[model samples]
Target chain A: MRRLAARVAPPTATFLAGTLLAELLIRALGVSPLLLPTPSAVARAAWSYRETLLPALASTTGAVLVGLAASVALGVLAAIALAASRWVERAFYPYAIFFQIVPIVAVAPLLVIWFGYGWRAVVAAAFIVSVFPVIANALAGLRSVDPALLDLFRLYGAGRLARLVKLELPWALPSLFTGLRVAAGLAVIGAIVGEFVGGGGLGVVVLGAMRQQRTDLVFAAILHASGLGLVLFAAVDVIGRIVLRRWHWREEIP
Target chain B: MRGSPIVGLAVLLCLVTAACSRGGPPAGRVALALNWKPEPEFGGLFEAQRTGAFRRQGLDVEITGGPGAPIVQMLAAGQMAYGIAAADEVLVARDRGADIVAVYATYQTNPQGIMVHASRGVNSLDELFAGEGGTLAVEPGLAYVKWLRKRYDLSRFQIVPYGFSIAPFLAEPRMAQQVFVTAEPIAARRQGAEPKVFLIADSGFDPYAAVVITTTQRVRERPDEVSRFVTALREGWRGYLEDPGPTNREMHARNPEMDAETFALGAVAQQPLIEDEFTRAHGLGAMSLERWRVLGEQLQELELLDQEPVAADCFAAF
Candidate 1:
């Protein structure tokens, strides 16, 4: 009971306090529902439109998960290639930076043109926006090996593959997980942007509701989108902890 | 205090009459919000402001542009005195208990339609649906698309998301897309493609566009002001049709992104549609109760509106 109370009380209290304050402030100011709907109205709307919102929420979450998985797989491989030689990094690194710099909204239309719509374009959009962080972080971890350890490996006449697999890859885990965490959030944003151009998901609901002037529904879409991002972030954090502990990665790093 | 009572009373009465003579105490300030940036689509409203027609009616009008801004929502919230939106949008708002009323309509027919390459030999909606199944780019959540799907047995066409640009349509010749009749055809022509246009209104689902709207509270509290604004708007439309050069120039100055050719073409193409037989017979910016009823029933049939709003309640008297 004490453990449950300790874990749950703070968040519940804070959320209740925030909701009460928002309700009171809006009521006092008499703000228009169009400009800003009250908390109770938003909650009611969220419940009323749960049928529509749930499916959209599921679709967005599915897109984000698929895109994030693909990004992690490609990003880690690219990072390994970069770590292998200076020439490889010089040739490919600029393109990664370019992808990051070009706004996702601008490229989304092109994705539709190339991929011909649907979740493939959405997944590709999320992958493009999210892959760079993993590449950068993994490369940094691979290259940050201790000089003394390198000397020991060389003294033992360790092969390139042996040195990489035995030492550097394990050291890269923490940095790779950090990248994954950041990419997880970005993946959801990319999915929403893709949906904005490619259609299907909470983005459609939000845009449609806004156009229709259903502010309450718009608020509901927002809540779902944020909840999706939060869940992705939290899932990445949990997986990182378990993997890092199971492999004794933390102890090996220092 | 020592002045004669008769002289004081005569002076006060003269002052009060003088104030009323200047069009009833310096007409109220009104903000008229447009859905998109300043362009030929809103030529009449822009002309009204530029030509001081609104001022003559004792109104201080502020014409503002909204790039995807919610105009009807703002009006319902009493944030603005007037706004221009599509009739369908007003119906949706009304269904949600918004007290907005459509005062006048600028477009006699909706310009929304599907455009396809002429080479594809898909001349009509039926042909496009029956043909070897290419992608149809449309905005998500468009009520018209839903209506089209339900009205015509079009199960073969694959629905793809549209990005509000003509580049995708240009690159893929066989692909069909939704477009504004006055707008995208010009863009496609610039790209060396003659798009076969199909106006959605011809399908017997015409909705008013560039509809002038205000709240019911305003209609009850200030009916005279609403009437004056609508009258000024009518004159503005006539002036715009006669010689749109000045209004076009002014709009181009405000929204330089619209190229001169496209702006000119839009101004020319829009005039005929804006002044169709109905508008010609009734005068510019004219709307009738019977027309509103027809629109209301169509919307209800489409399920765009949850319930049919009384036509009289939806539009105010001109």
Candidate 2:
């Protein structure tokens, strides 16, 4: 009951308080509605540009989903490969660092020029930007496997693959997920920044609107992008909590 | 080590295949950069390419869309043989030390204008200024905001910092805005509202917009090539005004999102703007040294820069 009150009630109170304050401020200041539009004006603007707003939301979501999926796939595969061979990890770590070191801004245009605009370029940029954290964490996790744990599995004649699936991976899940959560926030940033620079999606639209001096619609798009990032982070957090709670014996709050 | 080379090669191969698959001509490779995106304003140049005007001049043009690209750096680095820059920008750049020149005029008029609602009952500049309730939508970075303040006591008028959207203007019925007549007015008309317009030019602020630019060094080195490019570009504009059919089809092909009517309107609107004796005397794609110098002087007065940016190198007199 306390958890329910804690989780569900503050936002309602805040929203009501916020509305009262906004209306009060509007009436108090003699401020022209055009320069600093009332919340109602923003809501009306939101309704007006629903056409532009909805597509941009869809575009940004699509870019983020596609990027996250790509990151998960590549990040897992890199973990597996690195788990199998230290030589590969040693040889490629510098290059991985190199890719991370080169600012995404520097690489974004060339990605567009090379990949030819729109979702493909945006996805590539996001994937490249976000996977590093997951990879770095997963690699560290794989290396963190207890020597005695490996030997215990091997004593039963467990093969390399089975030992990896059952023993090494379970051992690595907590650290790996830490990387993924860090990557989760970064994936959203990657999509927005990539689009800001050149992706031609909602990020582009938000930026274009701002450049053209359409702050109302720009803020509306920003709200959408924020809602998207928040939603993604929440979803990932929930999944991480569930998976980690069971796998690593993490306790549930309630 | 060996596999790395192969992987690198594969990436390059993919990039080349992506860039070249929608193939056109095979002249010496050249990149023409824009001040902005694939808007209707750029249709003439694209139409020129569609009509084989650039090809006839033995040029292979790769038009890059501008999105926060540091255009002058790219030009100075020899990435693009030609770039589009406003005359005011050209002046600031020259003063700040970028070696570029203006070779062509895309829009005869800059098309930058202040728009208001007809119902505002503000008959002229004086009336607009007199009103206590009106909000003047102005962009902060644009040079003209200062010009407006210098000429008028803007402290009295409620100034709304512009963030480019028609929604703000549409949201508030009585508000005034700054926008290009070619782009925003069309968008407004589509929304079933006729907008009142006042040109900054008429208000005594002078500068050019969407003028084709190149390095002065490149012009000196490849005079004939530059001449060929300019001549073809001029022919492109003429053909755009005369027919614009093939160009429209090509522009549609490249960016199908732009509607045909709006595209045609944008093209047609830009035509009357290409007047003034400078272009009239020589041909289209003409600029006046006197005009450039005058704009430079205004920019200096406006204090856009500390000094003049480029010599009045308007026409590429090869």
Q: TM-scores across all candidates?
A: 0.87, 0.53
The CAPRI classification for model 2 reads as incorrect
Stretches of candidate 1 above 4 Å error?
A1-5, A20-31, A38-51, A85-95, A247-254, B1-29
Please give the range of 10 consecutive residues that has the lowest summed lDDT in model 1 chain B: B1-10
Clash pairs, model 1 backbone: none
Best by lDDT: 1
* Residue B106, model 2: Cα distance from true site in angstroms: 2.1
Q: Write the per-residue lDDT of candidate 1 for residues B1-318, one digit (tens) a residue.
A: 111111222432343333233332134788888877787888888898899999999989988736655666556545578998888878878887778999988888888899999988877877777687777888766768877887886566667766778888888876889988777888799779978988888888778888999999899999999999999999898899888889989998998867778888988988777998877787887777887888788878877776767887878758
Candidate 1 lDDT for residue B114: 93
